[model samples]
Target: MIETDAAGKIMFARRALFAVLFLVTMVGSLCLAALALSPGGFGIFDVVVLGLFAITLPWMVAGFCNALIGFVIMRFSADPVAAVLPAVELVRDDDPVTASTAILLCVRNELPERTIRNLAPMLEGLCASGYAERFHLYLLSDTGDAELAIGEEAFFSELIATWGDRIAISYRRRTVNSGFKAGNIRDFCERWGNRHEFAITLDADSFMPADAIIRLVQIMQVDPKLGILQGLIVGLPSTSLFARIFQFGMRLGMRSYTIGSAWWQGDCGPYWGHNAILRLKPFTEHCQLPLLARDGEIERHILSHDQIEAALMRAAGYHVRVLPREDLGWEDNPPTLLEFMRRDLRWCQGNMQYWRLVTLPNLTLVSRYQLVLAILMFIGSPAWVGLLGLATAALALCDDPADVMRSDIGSVLLLWILVMWFSPKIAGALDVLLAREERRAFGGAGRFIVNFAIETGYSIILCPILWISHTIFLFGRLFHRDINWMVQIRDDHAVPFELALRDLWPQTLVGCLSLGLVMYSQPWALPYILLLAGGPACAAPFATVTAWALLGGLAARTGIGRLPEETAAPEHLLDLALPAIKSASRPPLTSSV
Candidate 1:
């Protein structure tokens, strides 16, 4: 009890420190925003601009804090992972596998062949390690498409024939994915939750080795209070340039960001829906979805259930933790820019639903704060795009540029915002460069630095491109247009220009108009606007080029954005034969994309 109390106090102190730093950064940004907009007088336009800027600042501030803290812990701590998560010390190699676990793979119109391909190795590893008996495989599918269901049924038969004897394998499909993934899992909890002490959830794209799985189960066995334990889900190495470069940047920023977040967040860490282990009984009982009233009916469900589930689990007095390390878990990223936007929009829709649960009872303050942050993650897009529109209006309306805009303050604010926006990735790069082993793991300093630069440019262009998509979708959401939660294409493929144009025409139009107005009004500010606007203007070409087979093939062959897995292929990943890893290595196989 005393140790627990001390841990709680330590966690409180960390949060308090984070709050102070976050407030300082936000307040400073607001001051700069005010100075940049209203040097002469604070008009209605300036007030609105400030309001939008305020709305948009928290996400950036939180990112900056998480990145900065994560970087410090990563660089200074002797054993970074163990320092953040002391439970690491409890999991010894010989920790007995006493608890029964359910390997739950949820499918929704996904390719059964791909699912089996990913599952085969995991099953073999489990059997080889002699843990197969303790783990049962559940194919929790919600395939509404009849044709897809046929394929799934056939594949499940084959899957059963091959490995059902070694490890218990079962397949269950719902005609409709009523609650989507959360609903699918809820069904599992009702039918089979009692059978397993813990459940390891896997998305169609997600893959975990037997060792990672056993390690997680062991961690949970030791920590009775631990409800959910999430490992860092690295992107499976790809031949697609889009996934490769995108994940490289994500890899850099994610390490420090997650480490810092895990340090402060402690037990109340994030559960990213998949690539995680969950205690079955408590999750079933305490984490029930609250009735969402949409247009005066309790028919709606929470789209983004992981964060809320974490909050609920914490409220139930259980620790929701994340293991801040890579190589333990892997997932396939959207192979093209267009596919990325589609997936992002679904998340955008789901996260926007957090407004309904932000006030749920018994949740810790930090839990509620996380919900708010999740909402802001997507909502802030409108504010950012609003600020852009407001700036364009301010520029066009003013006879003199100095009337509504101050270039000196504006430039500083721009630089500051960019720094914060990219702070995590920058902090990550610094962490790698500072460490000899990490740098070498990323194919030495030269290759790592080159990858970092390319990823940086890719990110700058990608942010606004996604932001515009978010902006448009959020507005449509206001009018009751919702995105369909469909199966995402996991494999790499070429994105044709015509298809790119069809999807990104709105971004292109908005970009061109916004830039043209800024250029004609204030020609000098063209460069500044280009950072955000250039992306939207060239969204089509950007999408097409990023998905080009030849370019992607060349990048994979040349190790342009080589990850650790590509540099030194892991034992388990060798089987997958990831294009990038295979190209870089003598024979084999990763990042977050």
Candidate 2:
């Protein structure tokens, strides 16, 4: 176990300060509002509402404070922290270094052609940088389908024929997908991990610059104790309106938030599964995940393994760091709202599983806190729905309806909710506007403002729909329902109208019932009621793939959510990679070579 050093002490002190401040702000604001709402006296309903508020209020405040700290750091700091490799100069054609690193591309039953296309650029970039000899590339496949396996082999053969002479490229397909991606990596470690000092884990859609990859290796070489180092991954290039808007907001907010979190977290940071480097020996020794059993029944193995791995490494006396770099890495986003939720469904289940592991023996306090925060991330949605239900119940039981509506407490609570919910977006917008260079990258002040306005409006409408859907997913897990391990829908395709309605009708129903109830007793809450009802009413159309595509296209044409990558493509990397993949010689479908 790692001892808390001077830096660690400072980090802990700052974290303690933030924690106390957050608790005080959250509890004071909520308690004051509770007292004001029930001026006459405390009733059973008031007590219940307050208790529910106490449970949910910290989640909201924690997010707000994180964003608030991020905004202050980005706005005030002379030189804000960013994720950049140390002193990476342009490599000479003859420059070569010797370091053994394995680049593992773990794939399930995904489109093999697309995966090759994505991999081609990084391969070409490495060759061009003269680092081709330093790294070995492995296409580790856990494909279960017989036909897909054949296709994958055909592509792999072609790739090997072209690049085998220059780079140590190989392919292996496992008949059984045993432990999923984590298991796939563990298998590799057992077989060949000892040969390499470090391994860079990548997802199917992950793309990193050659320089960035080399930089990661160099950093690991310097810090022998670093177990995992995660780079910031921005959304990949997208023309679709939904993706552009979603990515644009993410780009704006992710940097500042990450930097601020890193400052407080210090050594004990997050490890996103992909676009990160792991030290092989330490990972092999400390990161084997345990299977959890409950009440004589063995539950499915852990779905989200990255964070647990990081925690395990830290518990074994290693540091896990997240490098906040904008240009280093890229990954794809779900192109439509329905696809987004489908992905969220899996993630919600995985994050919720952490509840079982938080109390695991010998884990650090910060590590445990991280697990709790992750659990709260999904659980907060249901808790939010619970809070609204309690408030509605209190309203129903109130003897004087006029007092409930007219009290200054109602206004304060509404204002508090709105401010806390949207403050991160506000801070992100400020970060964009404050820096002239960043502002110009997003197409100047006017375009930036327009994009923020549109994104905020869209998010407000989508909030309740997501809330209801997440609540359903969480409750489903409570009943021990099985989640299918399905390939993500990466391409933009139209969702059928009937299918959209079938999936989202429950959300629509909840919206209608909640709005109807509020309107009957408290017509003054029409504004909030409308916000709750809007998402469900719009769910069918938004859920339709074609509808969002059209909206995304319109938004793109109007310059609402413009990102720099869209305007300025990474020509050096993509130009070399895309052409090579398209023109590469391919073997016949039936060829066994």
Candidate 3:
């Protein structure tokens, strides 16, 4: 076991290594950009391009650094999970569960039946663990719809009658969801937080098996210093083509990205607001967010509350860690492009609000950095769009080939940026490929490789479109547009061409104009411009087609973006009858289940 001093030394070394990798990439890339632009004698257009290029580097660099480290760990480590999360070794599976944990199921205007379906497995698992008494389940509702509230009440009453005796279970609903989810949780902490030693926060869409929940509780019980132990949450297998493809990439990207991050991030890791356990006492006392608005106002409240809470928790001297283990925690992602955009925009607004909270006192340097990184995560989108726009305009004005850049250096720089931009997924692919058993679990190396390529192209088409959405959103904030938290629509359905066109015209317009400028001024740059601007150009069609029911079913039939859960589900997940599991002809991946 690593001593406290030894752990601190290892943490320092890893962070320093990350810093070196990030700085090297930034410095080297800027120099390449300067060299490429220097050929024509750096002008205003060249200078602004370089500035935007620099602004875009951190996000990409962070991903590359994390992925590189993560890939190395996955490729080399005998036990990758332990390599990243050494604290896991402190607790034993058979460790006596002593602390009482509050299972916080935070929901707002959600379908109660669906929410209940996701909760039952965990309750049953807890009962089987013979530690059901140690866990209290709270169905905390923030439903605004009158009809939905009725359903929620009925569901809770039924759930309470059934499981109240088996496990300590209760339900509460706020008439007004004041601070949204943050408020919902704050209400819980104030009411029942002191009663329990820990709280496991779960969203309406989140699920954790019984053993996973028990393991987290045990880990926390063993380590009193751990304020937040965030489990890695993968997307649940889905029938929606958009969701499956989106999550397949997520499943691949988040693993290595998380492992790499946890290695250096140590105690200042992420809290994704769901599928994680938190110590309730310090959390209730110290993580209180400054309410943005008054008594009943909802619009002016905090939207992105998880990261700030994590920072505040760290500020209070408690460790916050993300466990980089897969198939333990799962969630249902946005089922279509439109829902995805709405969710992204909400977060963009929320992160922008952190400009005020980032100033909160007592935050550790790393905690402050995490807050800033959250802001940059959204800010980088506009930088990307701006860079692409300026380059397009630069091409439009250039008559001669030597007018803007030296082609060789420009090509190298573009390739470098593209490679780094896709580095997380690239590293994720390598992590799986390097492990023979991992490849088999992903339905063999060949299928996994093919899916990787398809998901990459899907991302290429989707990212820029979302970038435009994010760019527009940031601009709207300047004009005081009200972007508040809205209940997520989490069901499978086909997107109409009209709805896609209405929401995605900006992307299409940008794409069309970019192509026209390239063809008119410098015809040769069209191919290069297509790689950058083409996604938005094809946005409407991309959304409509991917959300088409027939296409989705066909994709599912062929297992185009088949996740491990779909290829062979856990026995526990089998009862959930996930789309893939329902369709599977094979056995589960886990022998014990």
Candidate 4:
């Protein structure tokens, strides 16, 4: 019997909050040490700090340097060289019409009505696009529930009845949910992929604008060298505080990741599973995923199949690419912080398993290094925080408070924290100001400033929570603990205050101890250290309490900050609808010989 009382809910929230705080403390400590502390201890800190200052100071001082260089180069350089390969226009008078299938992978226990509502646009996309006759849609249900299956069948039937012969839709149920998502797609490919030249994969919550789909097909048809083309995946910020923050930060911080990946990777950019298209033959041929060794920590159905598949493609000498930013698609954000953390934990476990792949034979240096770098970035947060905590304890216990105060290490650490806290936001703010469409979402320059402030403030609060959670997750993985793959809950918005309290109490305890230590010893380094220790210790509750305040403010001010102006469905898409027939073409799909 589950308890319905506030007490139970509060306990859950407190646990969640504490998880985040723990991660932050552990990460902060490690990052400070890694950046400042050298092998010889305090003696090295000065040299390392001065070196970094020299390296970074120039970039800060020479803001106009790159722009001026670019300006001069562009003036003298030949028109940016066009692609040497001529575009293979699929619509050419003599080309064969290529038939492809769309595989929409629906995971465990997904909501029925929402799935249908969200997918309706894609169905319409098939009919409206010129390739209606050449594409078939398959909804692969990994869920075994009898009721949801029945609901999906009915919904699919309704779609057929409305559009008739113009669109074709079908459903498939797997006997086993093995390999998680990777298995789902593999199973479909073995059974249905041979019938199509390409397959567009979609996660349950992923959606692409109609034109984006058309563009995907065009690129695949033009470039036979391309095995996969993945587009930018943006977040849909549902009306929740946590959702808003996630969407805002991702929109800003992820550009560097996206741009850097595409630039450095060229044709080998990693696929993110959804919002992407794949040429069927190459994927089914080269991406025959091998089973992991018995000693491997990752489960058969692990979290990062996408990364693995991309690596396999490169190993097989095929090309994968991140489509330019012009292609637009969106993914729904997990509605609350708890959901986000749960999803991330599953990913951490899987990625930690993949850390071994860095040493796999026959891999390109770039691919190997990228895999290793990802592992470091993911695990480094916790390691950093743990080191910071240990350092604080050492200063308090071993060094005299006066001696620690006189050391320059503490000030360098403080400066590093400040730079990390604000630099990304400043970079993103500049990007937003530069983009016209993003600027409209902020409702002009004044509102953009307000939006940036709210988002940046929330990020500072969330950083410690996520840092703490990651630390706990990394520790658990290192000890070989069992971690479950959980569904990222998308609709729950409000977290009960009692739950928040339960999750936050552990951080509160840590904070109390740190504050007490600083007050009693008055260590010079303690003041700088306590903030990192006390932040998640204090910020979690402050966030949970203040969650409703922003929405309340927005409620009074009519439309101060909102999503971009809704783009109306273009005229051409209106007439197209799902087919009006209850029949599956049941095409014979066999594996490539």
Candidate 5:
């Protein structure tokens, strides 16, 4: 690993270069666009447009630069050094496990049967690894529903009876879930953390190979200063077309992006809550979350706790880092667009809550920047919307619509924005294309290209819908509206028309308003306006459960949007753990209450 001071210096230099490039590009582009839009003079409308541009340019620039750096790093670096832990060979079958570790499976009102189905294989694998005595597994439930709790108990009882003697297995359900998942974990730390050196937290949907789990423990044992080691998690075993498309892109993009991020973050990397191993002593002592005061409400719980925990760990002088290993961990994605939006809404609120803690005492500058970026991720959508509105108003009020359309600089700016927006996906595709092994794993060049094109098209159609959903969600969160902590919908089911309409009317209204305004102001720009509005206008229908099923089936028959795991899984444990892919048509047995 690079020395801490040397790494910090390099990261600072890279960040400075990125900032300079971003400012130059954004200023140059905006100035050209402004000249094209109004060569006569600057006006109030132009000033508003420029202000919106200033607010939104950083997000665009950051994304492009990140992708560029990631592409270069992944293309050139064969084996990047891990930032947090020293490299070690995998433990042999006869190697005696010295440290005690706990696997904490945290669940809420999720399907107990499904959870058991996923867990049974991992437990079997652990026993097979010949280190069963060294590791214990805990079923940490926060279910409040009486019937669901009983079902969870029944499942836990059966699982314990099946494998209790093979490994230490325990179950606990909270009567009152005070702070959600974070609180559940804190409770576990208070009760059992002292007994173990490390705890590997897992979500209900998380799956990791037993060997990978062992490797994490080994790495942590080697590095006493390591507080958290996060593994790269990719979406897997998706059945729906929407999920397949979304996850395929995620799998492609995350590998390189994570490596680049880890390089820059160095010792102060992010913790994504799960699919990570944490040193119990430091975590328990340093990462206890305190409530934030907001609008007369004292003791307001943090919605997103993982980043804060990582920050706290760093504040206590422990290194937190992410391992960018794509082959290790797996997770599930929302099966439908509406469900995805629902999940995103919760994340939007959680990330926005970081604004409350960005200036918390004892945070490193990098940690504070991480918090600020988290807030900007959601906030950028609204800023983009404002920019669009200002640009549209300027166009509508312009004395010469013909001149605005004739301007080559305006067209160039539009093209540049599109390129920057999709650069990450392009970079990911290039990474795959350049690597023979990666391309082969994606089912050869032809199939890979087909999948890439389909995913890109799907993402474009879905982007506007997300933009509107996130903007509204951000506004609601700012107003201190409470989000009901509910179980995530994980199965494929058709959304009710009424539900879709109720959820998506704001998007539809925005689409209609945008189209109407554009048609009134510049009929020549109708195509751009329609493109902007189409996704939102059709979001309700597109979000129908029936629509997702049909699209998924069509993609399946066409042999497009196939994930590498679906084509050929690298981990034997995955096949053993999940013997059969669950059918999308199977209804979820539990409610997300």
Candidate 6:
């Protein structure tokens, strides 16, 4: 018995060492790949391998690090820890003097009028709060097109004129959209950051209850070390079936991960660009625009600038926190499957950019690992595909089937992959029911099943689309292609089937290839292959089906089976969507299209 126990311990230690060694090798491979990017470059295959190695290493590291951090914090920390609200100390609202806050809403070309109108309720909620006197609203527009800019300006002006001092309103339009959102915010800081002690940054489509913003600011005042506080963003369901599923997944399953992440890291967790409050001085002074070496090509405006900026602040010894989604900040999600993919592809490019960061100097091991983990999450789909491909190829070429099975090794590897893939969702689901404020969003087991059906199905479809899109984005960077940073363009209406077919064809191709390969190489793997294939192949049908069901449900509820009406929106959301009100002679905000 003693000997068996000793053997088990030895095996565990060996696996740990293997994991570490594998990571070190990955780091080395990335360094070589990056080094190959000099004037004298390597061949296409070499560049591709190097690029993949470099981009993927961080994700691998981040997962390991997140687990390790969870262990340490859970074991060592003496604080009341929840990922969303870490160390929730009882804060007294002593500041009866409603501190004035400038809610900075950054927007591009979209339905400015509709988005602004939707956010009216939230803004009204803020005004209803005693601190209404202290909260000022700023509509920052980056809409560059003449017609859209004109439309936005008029819409914003009317909104402000209509509101008439319920909230002090200001607007700015950037002439050239530099640095995406980060640059837009930086520009604001340079022009007027000093005007306010703190700024609440929001996406054009995002909204938070007035109290959440007020409370966040009050908490910031209490903690001097904090630089940025990220609020949990709940997804708002829309008419589209795709939107409904994503909203549920994000609100329930995904929210927990953000909460767990925030709880584990507290201030170390990076700032999400939207639905967050930030200290102006640190962001402007410390979060300088990253100079792009290839200018419009590689490293253009730091693709994931928000994460990078948060990393920079943390490295500089400032705190960045993830606040609980329980506070009620909601965001407009991508309404269609295609729109979701387009947005994710951009994210893939930015996440891949983190590889350049891991090699930079002065980062803590924890932060470096965090960047790596994020990278992994982005690239995991392709990596899984590639890994599966390699295993099949190896088995096909080899004579001994038993040798190929290598059941112990394959089983462990497969298990780890599954855990990494599904843990976030499971973690999130757990967090949803646990958080008092968010629990109401999710019902009992019935809602859980519905949410799962939508998320699992939608995520599967998105996998292949993103895998290809990210591959192209990464390939562009490797070959040094010029890439522009743009805000995710949001549309309220569903896209036509023709557009859906156009976007889905590539995913269909890869998924088909994967299915063919799995059948030929390992017939026993049929069930898994079909399971994965169902996501991509049936994506359109699934969405259509889901949408039909939702419509039917809505019809059953309302006497006239018409489309459901949009709920009253928050005011901060309106401020974000309304066109950039042109101040005295500045540049016009650019349109997203």
- C-alpha lDDT of all candidate models, in order: 0.88, 0.75, 0.86, 0.58, 0.77, 0.60
How many collisions between residues are there in candidate 1?
Answer: 2
Query: Looking at candidate 4, what is the lDDT of residue 108?
Result: 61
Better of 1 and 6 by TM-score: 1
The whole-model C-alpha lDDT of candidate 6 against the native structure comes to: 0.60
Task: Give lDDT tens digits, candidate 4, residues 256-358.
Answer: 4354334334555778888888888889998866666545654454557887778777777777877645236777777666677678777777777676677
Model 6: residues with Cα > 4 Å off, grouped in runs: 1-90, 294-299, 359-362, 379-381, 391-401, 407-416, 430-441, 482-489, 495-497, 517-522, 531-534, 538-593
Query: Which candidate should be chosen as best, given lDDT against the real structure?
Result: 1
Q: Write the per-residue lDDT of candidate 2 for residues 1-593, one digit (tens) a residue.
A: 25547656777787897788788878787777675667657777667666666666666677677777878877886655542222123333234455699999999888877787777778888898777988999899998989988998998999999989989998999998767788899999999999998999999878787777877787677677789998889987564666767887787668656776776776788998999999999999999988765446434578889989999999999989877777778887887778888888888888888988999888999899889888877777776677666656655566676455446767787778777777777788888787777776666677778778878777777777888888888788778775777878787667778888899998877777777777787767667666656676678776774335665555555555666654444664445343212221222112111
Model 3, global lDDT: 0.86
Model 5 lDDT per residue over 1-593, tens place: 56967856877886677567667877886776676557656677567766766666666666677677777777776555443223434334345667999999999999987777667767878899888999999999999989889989998999999999899999999987877789999999999999999999999988887877887888787778889999989886665767878888887777656766666667788899999999999999999998766457445677789999999999999999887777668888888887788788888888887887888899998899789888777777887777656657766787876544446776787788777777777788898888787776666688788778877767766888888888787777667687767888877677777888998998878877777888887878777766567677777777784346676665544445666664465555345433123232123222211
lDDT of 2 at 443: 63
Q: What lDDT score goes with residue 242 in model 2?
A: 65
Worst 10 residues of 4 by lDDT: 578-587
Model 3 residue 431 distance off true place after TM-score fit, in angstroms = 1.5
- TM-score of every candidate: 0.96, 0.90, 0.96, 0.76, 0.91, 0.76
In candidate 5, residue 150 scores what lDDT?
92
Which clashing pairs does model 2 show?
A: 83-324, 241-552
lDDT of 1 by residue, 1-593 (tens): 99979988998999999999999999999999888887679988889988998998889899999999998888789988998889999889999899999989999999999888888889999999887899999999999999999999999999999998899999999997778899999999999999999999999988899999999999999999899999998888889999999889888888888998888888889999998999998999999787576566446788888999999999999999889879689999899998999999999998998988888889998899899998898888888788778777777778887887787998899999999999999999999888788887887787787888899889878988999999989889879888888778888788889989999998899889989998898888788888878888899999999998899998888777788888788888888766778788742222311
